[model samples]
Target: MNKRLNSVMARVAAAGWLIAAMLSAETVTARAEAVVAPADGYGFSVGAPMTWMSRAEADGELDAAARTGASWLRVFIDWSRVEPMPGAYNWGYVDHWINGALARGIRVLGLIGYSPDWARAPGVYFTGPPTDPAVFASFVTTVVQRYGDRVANWEIWNEPNLPLFWGYLGDRAAGYTELLKAAYPAVKAVQPGSTVIAGGLSPAFAPDAPPTFVAEMYDRGAKGFFDAMAMHPYVFPHGLEADTLNGWSDVERVRQLMVANGDGDKKIWMTEMGAPTSAPTAEGVSQQEQAKQILDGLRRAAQTPYSGPAFIFSIRDSDTANQDNREDNFGALVTTDWQPKLAASALAR
Candidate 1:
């Protein structure tokens, strides 16, 4: 009888432990699901000026972003500006943007790149790849440790496939892969829950298109280095469905490549997508067309199963007066004077 009682007690304890373990697993799954599903479906790029704006101006911009129903804001965590020298650092600008966005209930995707003069070789552009991946990784680790509590998503670089950004030397894909490999692990080590995104690939042709570049990254062992891939699919002067090379359609090809490489479970973030209303010559579109294309891109991204948040190129125009420079007019949601554009109304709907 004593032996039988002991056996029964042991079985009961085992059952209780098993039930608790099951509950723990379920809880983890629930949390993961919540993390993946963003509160707002899309985000907006507030441009590079967030670092320099006065608190009042930054608040106003963030208010405008929130009004558009954006739950995320893509801002640059520019290394050159933040850490101009080896040990010198500036957090004033970064703090204003990150805290302001959070105050408005918007999450931040911190795009980290641009080598400071000290970090790169002499005569190299600030946008050039760092002379040492470890140096860049150290900067990344420091940034993550500083803002990891508030900013969980980090992009390693921006448009590295382009010579203008990555410098005109070495293999672009190989060099970028090394940077990602270094930065991703550094970020993860500091904050295990952080999501390290590959630099947003620019829409280019031939040897530099997003699909081709992504494939090359994979070839250079880029897989598993990032939680998600990013693309700047700016199909300007063309509709979302237009059959043009290096257009929005390339996103699918990139996705297909990811799937083939057993990374289908990951997402592809449309980090920048928009058209300039006052673009140069044939590249410019009417305000109405800009609104339509942006809306269509947002809807398509939201509906796609493997897509991450789609961030419009800008929340407001950098300069509406600069009609010849397409870069200044990508802001379809708001004008520089704090006025809402047609796309803003459509987005609110």
Candidate 2:
């Protein structure tokens, strides 16, 4: 249930940085027990792709993700894939994915989101939010129950703070709090001990940018909504604004709301965070620069309060132009295929 961010010196996979996690950094010994995961202790989780794991050479890729350091494994379990048809369920994908990670001695962080067509759209959760709360609830309950004992943490959604995710103008869709309202109890009732984490949030440059996600959730009465929380607090190189300075980029600005809602005791997790190895666009940070960005934030995550483990967004280059569905190259100092970048070696500490 509890993991010690026991390993300190994580190596840089290659030349760039997969910047994430947040801390003001003092000293980090190469492979030293992470100063971030709370002396109370939480282990670092290595992120990997489902498609990659299905490959014959997946073992080598998994090994590379853990090359620097990681105690748990992070994977996205999409609703769209898990239950492609309404009422019909499939555990084949999640089972295989988690089993593979476990075989490597890694724990699992299962993310749940992106409702299936049967669940409908323009409504309750992710891009195509569920129309019926009960339908979504059934999905969550089934998945959590199946992996209840195996996986301790389950995230509800991804990048839930934007118009594309939680923010919807048509009929004021995505009703942020409602998604949790339905999911929290459903997931917990099946696995009372499992941690129902908030959907990962996106931290933009302008402190008070578009959604004001935290404020909206709190206003909608999001008190006691989750166990450990999460954020995507990704700021541009060397940029920190008040709203973007919670503990990490994803959970940005939400900590205060948690406190306001009388849930300060709950911890914060960075489900998605990383600096790309290369700029998918001309304005973005380079892949090499991303490696450094990751080190900066990760040090902070290990050292700060309300801070937990900061998992890099990706293990390899996913797409080009991270923005606009571009690849953004948010690896932890290496290319997606295990090519070593500058920061990769640095992070490998």
Candidate 3:
């Protein structure tokens, strides 16, 4: 009887030690995450599209971004503009803009998308998905081959779930997944070190809406294609803190989706996020409030373990591009002339 009791006590003690070890491991992991927290990791999207910016203007914007503590610049590669004809290509504009930004010490996130006229179906917008995945893949190969050494990060397309961007492709995850599959390999073949980031996804409302588009991508085995995922948690009008259209917690939801698909290891970058100060909507906030929300959102993102660099949209206001356009107004951080906004002062390195 005593031998039996001794054996049971030994088993219990072994179980207790295992529990203690697990607790210790969890604590260690938590500490690691805390250490890596990007509390002050700030970046911004220059409002001007890369396609139209001249070399001088591009340099000024890059300088401004570097001065403002921005380490990363997100700009559209615009396949339509770069490759206007079937085989003819105009590498002049992009080459100048990219090289200029890099010279300013700002890392560029080359957003490659928008179908060239020859690559698109009839009556569809230029932003629509390409008619043939091969055409898009070829464009990807060319851009990466040209700038692969200087640019390490490449975001494939932008907001594919939105109607404005992908109305031609529809919300068919398989369609976008196919594009990703094609483009990912093309990038890898040219620049093996290049990081292929899934396009920044927009926050969509319904349950089976935009967010599901990501789940669909995973379902189609897109996990193996890219290095990281991207998102645009605009959460505008609603204070950056408020969970508008459920966007406030989009980072969390996206993480959960990644975990469920066995992709919990991947990082989610906020490629675009900001609240507008003017052109009031039902949920609009004042200019001062916009500044406050920007800080709060950055703090919140920093605390998240899986969150990567958060790029606030628009380093400067776009007064010339339809001043009343709310999106144009989203850039209240500075005037079109580069005058500082309240939010500009709040952005510390």
* Candidate 3 segments whose C-alpha is farther than 4 A from its true place: 1-40, 207-210, 282-284, 320-323
Q: Which ten residues in a row have the lowest lDDT in candidate 3?
A: 28-37
Mind giving the per-residue lDDT tens digits that candidate 3 earns over 1-349?
A: 8756654553344234323433443233222122222553667776335567545445545555565566777877888887899878888877776776777777788889888778889888877888789889998999888888888889998888777787555655777899999999999999888789995888886533555778888888898998988887777777654667666576677788889888888888888877765556434556567766666667667877788788888766666245456666666345555445556445522
Better of 1 and 2 by TM-score: 1
lDDT value for model 3:
0.70
Model 1 TM-score relative to the real fold:
0.86
Best by lDDT: 1
Off by over 4 Å in 1: 1-40, 243-245, 279-282
Stretch of 10 with least lDDT, candidate 1: 30-39
Q: Compared with the true structure, what per-residue lDDT tens digits does model 1 show for residues 2-51? A: 75665454334423432343244323322211222222367888667676
Q: What lDDT score goes with residue 50 in model 2?
A: 63
What ranking emerges by lDDT with the best candidate at the front? 1, 3, 2
State in Å the error of residue 289, model 1: 0.9
Which candidate order results from sorting by TM-score in descending order?
1, 3, 2
Query: What TM-score goes with each of the models?
Result: 0.86, 0.77, 0.83
Off by over 4 Å in 2: 1-53, 122-126, 166-174, 205-211, 237-252, 319-328
Candidate 2 residue lDDT tens string, 77-120: 87887788976777665777678677767778888877777677
* Backbone Cα, N, C clashes tallied per candidate: 0, 63, 0
Each candidate: RMSD to true structure? 16.5, 7.7, 18.5
lDDT of 3 at 221: 86
